[model samples]
Target: RPATVDYMSVDAEAAEVEIFRDFPFADFDISVISVEVQAHNYYELDTIFVTAGYAKLAVLGGDHVYAKLRRPLVPPQGAAEWQRTIARDFHAHAPARSEIGRSQ
Candidate 1:
């Protein structure tokens, strides 16, 4: 029943995928998410987030994957313009390659 979560971090040991599956991605406005996953569960976790309209931002320390929502979240009145500006700036400054520790 949570409405908006700006960021979420999950380190659920072996239950990372399950926890992500249970999260209401469509019902809530989650801007960013990071999960600690084992090698066996990495694909499954990636699938869930990609299916939920998120794009992989980075893979940290091999096990932690970070993602951001593909689309912009609705902003409060008087903040929409500011949000758009920030988004533009972010995209401009974002890394050329999303993932880390990967051969270019």
Candidate 2:
């Protein structure tokens, strides 16, 4: 099912409180950090492409995740394979674009 959806940001403090209160087990077992970085460009690609790129970096970056940068790749290559190579190369530098911003 697909429909137009409106999006909003949740208060991070409230979200944390709720998660801890309702799912205490989850909190103790988990560490979650959310970051909002600005990519001032339109991304017109499949969800798989978008998500795989981020996840690969998150896992490989080892610490500084959430992508201070992202790179675009064309297809016929496997997502995981490309992501591995990208994570290695990407770690050295931040995203270089026309303009970039970071939002908490």
C-alpha lDDT values of all predictions: 0.75, 0.34
Encode model 1's per-residue lDDT on 1-104: one tens digit a residue: 64887888878878988888877776887877777788899888888877777877888875555556555343445467878888999998877775656686
Q: Show where candidate 2 strays beyond 4 Å.
A: 12-76, 84-104
Question: Against the true structure, what is each candidate's TM-score?
Answer: 0.59, 0.23
Which ten residues in a row are the worst by lDDT in model 1?
69-78
lDDT of 2 by residue, 1-104 (tens): 32322322223432333332343221221122332222321131113223433321342222212221234443458778778878988865766564357554
Please name the candidate that would achieve the greatest lDDT relative to the true structure: 1
Best by TM-score: 1
